[model samples]
Target chain A: MKKINLLFVLTLGLIFSLSNATFKTQGYQVGDTAIDFSLKNIDGKMVSLQDFAQAKGFVIIFTCNHCPYAIANEDRIIALNKKYAAKGFPVIAINPNDPVAYPDDSYDNMKKRAQEKGFNFPYLLDDTQDIAKTYGATKTPHVYLLDKNRVVKYIGAIDDSPKDAKKAKTSHLANAIDALLAGKTIAVSTTAAIGCGIKWKK
Target chain B: MKKTFFLALLLGLLAQGAHSQTIQTIKIKDLVSHLQKNDDTLRVVNLWATWCAPCVKELPYFEQAHQHFKNQKVKIILTAIEDELPKVQAFAQKRKLQSTLLFLDEDNANDWIPQIEKNWQGEIPVTLFVKQGKREFHSGDFTAEELMTQIEQRLNVSKE
Candidate 1:
């Protein structure tokens, strides 16, 4: 009886510690090596981080069609990819919202929106929402800039302004990329832009 | 006869619409100062948006609590962030949101997110429940039963 009780307590302790460890590994921070995912693009193709073989890094943005903030930054995101895709940094947008909660965010709608908005980059679908969870994307238009080695060089907003891009005082994402190209340290790494929170799976 | 019934229904709908008041836009500093009262009442500040599905889903819970705990010194305020006023006004009328409505009149989320709570990463459907002696934060949706349990637990703790 005594031995059994002792074993039970030891097992409980291990379970508690393991659960705590799982909570601690919820998401990524700066300098963390990001895990690659194979999500479906709007083109009916499976796209992964490793697919960009010749690229230097990626600009992973969690955005959707419904969110106004995402819609506001749509043009800016396209411009980023157009200017930077050949420069070795390509933009990869992922829609993490569950279609059940938001029918507009369905894969079909994603394709339509991409076409309507004239997206220059791959707008992927995180059907499982695992990528968004692991990346710790809290809001729509959240950005994570990666380097050649897939290390998260910078994270957070695209610019200081979300409501008005042309009136933005500073372009944080662009500045970060410029510094990376120049082999210099990024000055302002993370910034927060007011945006619609990413719609989570129920 | 049918036209008269339709006119009556429209009048009733308009009467119902009168209950949906416009949300006040308050600065973060003003909001914080408003929430800074030293009274023993429990202030429940819910951070939400008009477009947030989860926030909309959980709104009824806060509304129900607002009614059930009215005499218990619990005040509920629904604060919207980054949404168009007209859209939110329509939604407010459609949903018949009973909790006091307000909009956080500030941009630069990084600047104000920390002001609301240091650990908050600008997620919607976050509730800040506080009494004079104790404070608790809850993130995501909550059922009315769960919300009441939490409030009761806090009230009990603060009493002790």
Candidate 2:
């Protein structure tokens, strides 16, 4: 009877562990409360969503230096921060790529890129990639817009045209923010675009 | 005499161009139609781009699969999501890629990305395996062994 009980307990533990792994991989969905992360910023200071007390929301973008798609959207990311930071939704960029696989996406390079681009936002490093995993950011230039309460209002690409901003027909991220600020329902809360996959550490 | 020589040279150049594989530029609708085609052939559609390093690295695996499955009904299509034709053409020529090459000419990825796979978040190195009416979308890079195993498993599934 003791052996049977031990076996039953082990089996239950195994099932729970398996389910937990699945849940983590699925990451956040729209309306889900996003967990704040303390990632090291380019300025060598730790930053988190909770730090912005006065802000109405946050625009968290997972982007890297090596990706062409990310590079193309660099200007637009700056523009987003310039146009909306005062509106209470500031852009916070994160480099989630593994430095081992992509050396260009290393912390030092991220800092260099941020400085060169004259980023008007905080460029942070997800060294352990935990934040990216939790947010379910699969590719560079992936966006996750969260409300002041930390509820994820939007996820996916910044806009329709990732390669060329001039050719973009729709601004999904901006639209979601506008809707949220206006206290209206976001029509297109989620979108996807082609981008370089996040280089996971092997 | 000079005109004849120039004409001969032009013909030779044209013949050379014809011999080399040219990538066909296609719209999202064309791709959808291809995917919707009801056929026994297992269409292994690899969505990639020239600038994506991982995509470039894993391309040889698809090329090898294309060569290996030459006699079989397995079709390997390397669809590039690049706008510049010259770059894709040059890369294909330089690499000597043997798979069926195609260039997705659509700009609005948010519009057409869902058409390919609803859950796809527009990441490169994604592959779409289609046979009959069944479809399987695999995101991320694949090793040669893993690529072969996946193809073999799908082929076997189609047989049954």
Candidate 3:
């Protein structure tokens, strides 16, 4: 009788835990052709994915004004844009979090952040969050690197560190860009990106 | 009459205790020991700020996960990374965060962020899944479903 009761309890426990199981969507995959989406930049001008397809490659990063990770990397991203833009590559920043939930990440604040940071790239806001959803971006500072053919070469982190740069173990994003620029295939195509999760519209 | 007065006083004390079951604010230094002692159980620690919109949006998912595993032995601690104590407290009050909510008391980001996750870039809404020293740090907002899957997967691995 006790054995039967134990089995019943264990079954009940398993059922309870499994009922709440949820999974993140697997959207874009490596080697998949990148999709095109139009989003308004901080200056209110609409930018599309196709705008940069003519380049040798492009760095697409989902970032916002309030996330410390994104804020800390603003300088690095800007530098990447300047260095790579002249070399047929550009960095595109997208704000995917809900602006209402975060007033600091609103369009006005994005513009302020861009101006204050002297961002050379187009800092766009995904108002409907469609772009972010399509990309399966779960956090601020999520990155996607695409080659000239618009195939995803890398889909993960900006770098290995969000806190102390001196101690980072890997420069995943930069290394990927370097490999692509030098006509070498990237080794680490995906990584578990760490940062502020996206604030989806409630 | 003396007995009645004592009974009334006892009831008042109980009421106070019930109404003031506020989450005790423990320093990060103290939290490590508590976590260590609670081994054999999964701990999902989220670093967020009440001011962070993405953090706020994903707060409910964490709360749901906590409730789902309440009877089990999992601990879901939502630690606010807000430096402003008053604001953190007020936000907690306003949002009615029911999980074990804590405010990271550390102010030196350069010193502390690395301690939490070497790759952490001082971002809010960062979550850590730890079980028996096996840890996974995900920097992004998650839906309730995604959070639960990760928790379940971690717990399964821990059990194994």
Q: What DockQ do you compute for every candidate structure?
A: 0.26, 0.39, 0.15
For model 2 the TM-score comes to 0.86
True contacts kept of 1: 0.32
Better of 2 and 3 by lDDT: 2
Please give the distance, in angstroms, between residue B116's alpha carbon in candidate 3 and its true position after superposition. Answer: 15
True contacts kept of 2: 0.75
lDDT of 2 at B100: 88
Runs of candidate 1 with Cα error greater than 4 angstroms are A1-25, B1-24, B34-39, B84-98, B133-135
For model 2 the local lDDT of residue A72 reads 100
Off by over 4 Å in 3: A1-21, B1-160
Instruction: Give the per-residue lDDT digits (tens) of candidate 1, residues A104-136.
Output: 889999999999989999999999899999998
What is chain B's TM-score across the candidates, in the order shown? 0.82, 0.86, 0.78
- Per-candidate TM-scores read 0.82, 0.86, 0.61
RMSD of 1: 5.8
Highest DockQ scorer: 2
Cα miss at A143, model 3 (Å)?
0.5
lDDT of 2 at A137: 91
Q: TM-score (0 to 1) for chain A, all models?
A: 0.88, 0.89, 0.85
DockQ (0 to 1) for model 2: 0.39
Taking the tens digit of each residue's C-alpha lDDT, what string does model 1 give over B1-160? 9999999999998886577756898888977765666778888888888777778888888888887987787788888886767777888888887778998877777787767665555656677876774445665567778788867866676677
